[model samples]
Target chain A: MKRNSRLSLALHTLSHMADDPDRVRTSADIADHAGTNPVVVRRVLGRLREAGLLTSEKGHSGGWKLARKPERITLADVYLALDESLVATANEDSDPVCSVEYALHRRVSGVLREIEQSLVKRLGETTISEIR
Target chain B: MKRNSRLSLALHTLSHMADDPDRVRTSADIADHAGTNPVVVRRVLGRLREAGLLTSEKGHSGGWKLARKPERITLADVYLALDESLVATANEDSDPVCSVEYALHRRVSGVLREIEQSLVKRLGETTISEIR
Candidate 1:
């Protein structure tokens, strides 16, 4: 198993946006620079926009721009925007027939929650400006 | 996505073993304590056995026992024993049609590697005895 690539992509994009907060960069251009598909860039940007970290416009000369200052944003904000979970799992049945499975899940979930909170806390301490 | 329950199982089971050190535990018994399926515990044990963190026997009265002292083992050892990756991913094709996807994968992979290393470092600092 591997972590999602969206995490870094979101951070990288945010750094770019933060570098030039006043300029609006289209997804196409961002994708080109980032060496990815424009569609993928747009999808990521959409999530950031929804997170209120960025805003966008629809027109020939319109694209995406940061909604807030670079210092105000963190990696956690981007991760939340992408709706990425801190842990990974397969289809675990709602009713795990085995009690051991139940206990195992609970304990693991606790650790995962702790890890995630730690991750968020670390990310929270760093701003987009730092990455850029 | 959530992290693998096996990670916790490995750690928790190791902690228990460390506490007793002399008592051999059956999968069923361990599962009961941890609230999971015996099969799951056995499978996790199998991995631990392979990793040299544990060993098992297969007889009427046989079960599993730690291969090493609690002070000699860490959570990273358990995680490695379970072959669990620090990151999570869905089927990412070897050939990403999009360059951004490729770049994203590389960057994410880098960060994941760093995080995994960090986790291992932290886990290495603590032993099963500590957890117990």
Candidate 2:
């Protein structure tokens, strides 16, 4: 499967915030470090905020910061918030009704679910603090 | 990161071959099962043949079959042949040279490599024979 960039950006940004959990990182600053548009950075951070992974402020001096200790956050949390898939699966339209196709999809789906669980379990074991 | 569908199709095809291990499945058959274009199925199958995952034959009875025993094949091998990424990483254009961005990329790259290793290791442990 193709690698998606958004998830990477989110994790990288979270790691930075984890490094200095006490300080607020303006979206501009994060955008500068991420080398992406400030709007993009804000959009990702906004999701994190919505998920309670981080908190943000809108004022001049305000920005974003980890909502909780880095030790409490996991990569899985970030990934889930981003709604990324760990395993590749046939698209819905790839094959709709043949019994063989159905069987294959069922098997592949099972494998993906397993892999997703494994990935989440691994990510859950590592806190944002540990990455920093 | 969002999982791409192409890789899944490639792997699913290989798995089917590994199950039978000897039968030559036609492009039309595979496409019928995969619910995709015969051309798309052939294209993916072509790559597998190139990678020695399977061999294809032409003409009325010609189709595809695994190049090797399921026991000799690994999911990781199929995944690599499909050229799918296991971890999400920032896109090249996301940020081009900021120190923080670079550093983050480096770290994430390292992690991806590690995860890739772990994933392959696990996949390698299971052969197509075992899956079937």
Candidate 3:
């Protein structure tokens, strides 16, 4: 399966915003810096706004800006904003009759849950300011 | 991007093999149980064999079997056998001139590396025997 880079892209865009909080960054400009299309930039940043990490303005001089200081936003915050699981598991519901599959799924799921928790905790320890 | 489930699939397949070590399972049989195609099963199991976790034999009775006891095989071993990164990074080299991009890439890479190492360590703590 392909790996998602939304987190990376969001962080990249946020860091650019943090570089100059007063300067509004248009989707086209951010996309140019991010080596992606404006639609993708807008899509990712839109999630960031919904997460309360960013704000978008409309009309003349309209663009995206961080809602709070970089120090106030942690990597964990960004991660949660992206709304994706940190790990993947097999589709357990896909094969209900197989006891072997059930047992395997249970164990793997438990371990993955632990790993994701650990990752989120570690991420919470780091703020966007620390990275920027 | 879609999350890859190869690790979960490998663990599931290994647990099944561990349940009856004396029984040799064919690719088709494993595929049926794995809710995947035979080719997918063979491809994944082929990596497990190359990692010395299983053995494949040829002949009318030929199939696949664990090369060692389940207790000796850790989830980390299975993960390494699959040879996939636990985390994804943006294509950093895609934009070389942007310093903001560079800073974001460096920090993100460091965090992901730490997360991967932590994940591998946790996986190493559990073995196929425990899961089975």
Candidates in order have lDDT scores of 0.70, 0.73, 0.78
How high is each candidate's TM-score?
A: 0.70, 0.87, 0.86
lDDT string, candidate 3, A57-107, tens digits: 999989988899888998889988988666655344664656756666677
Can you rank all candidates by lDDT, best first?
3, 2, 1
A1-132: candidate 1 lDDT, tens digit per residue: 123657656776777676679998999888876667899888878888888999999998999999988899976788778877644343455566467556655555555465556655555665777652
Instruction: Name the weakest run of 10 consecutive residues (lDDT summed) in model 2 chain A.
Output: A87-96
- lDDT (10s digit) by residue, model 2, range B89-111: 53465445667667766776666
Candidate 2 lDDT at B27 equals 88
Better of 1 and 2 by lDDT: 2
Q: Worst ten-residue run, lDDT, model 3 chain B?
A: B88-97
Candidate with best lDDT: 3
- Predicted complex 2: DockQ: 0.41
True contacts kept of each: 0.18, 0.34, 0.38
Model 3 chain A, poorest ten-residue lDDT window? A88-97
Candidate 1 local lDDT, residue A83: 76
Tell me, what's the RMSD of every candidate? 4.8, 3.1, 3.0
* Model 3 lDDT, full chain set: 0.78
Residue B126, candidate 1: C-alpha displacement in angstroms: 3.9
Which stretches of candidate 3 lie above 4 Å from their native place?
A1-3, A90-92, B1-3
Q: Candidate 2 docking: what grade?
A: acceptable
**Top TM-score prediction, candidate number:** 2
For residues A1-132, write the lDDT of model 2, one tens digit per residue. Answer: 124667777877887777778998888888778766889888888888888998888777888889899889887788788776666443455435767667777777677666667767777776666663
What would the C-alpha RMSD of candidate 1 be, to one decimal place? 4.8
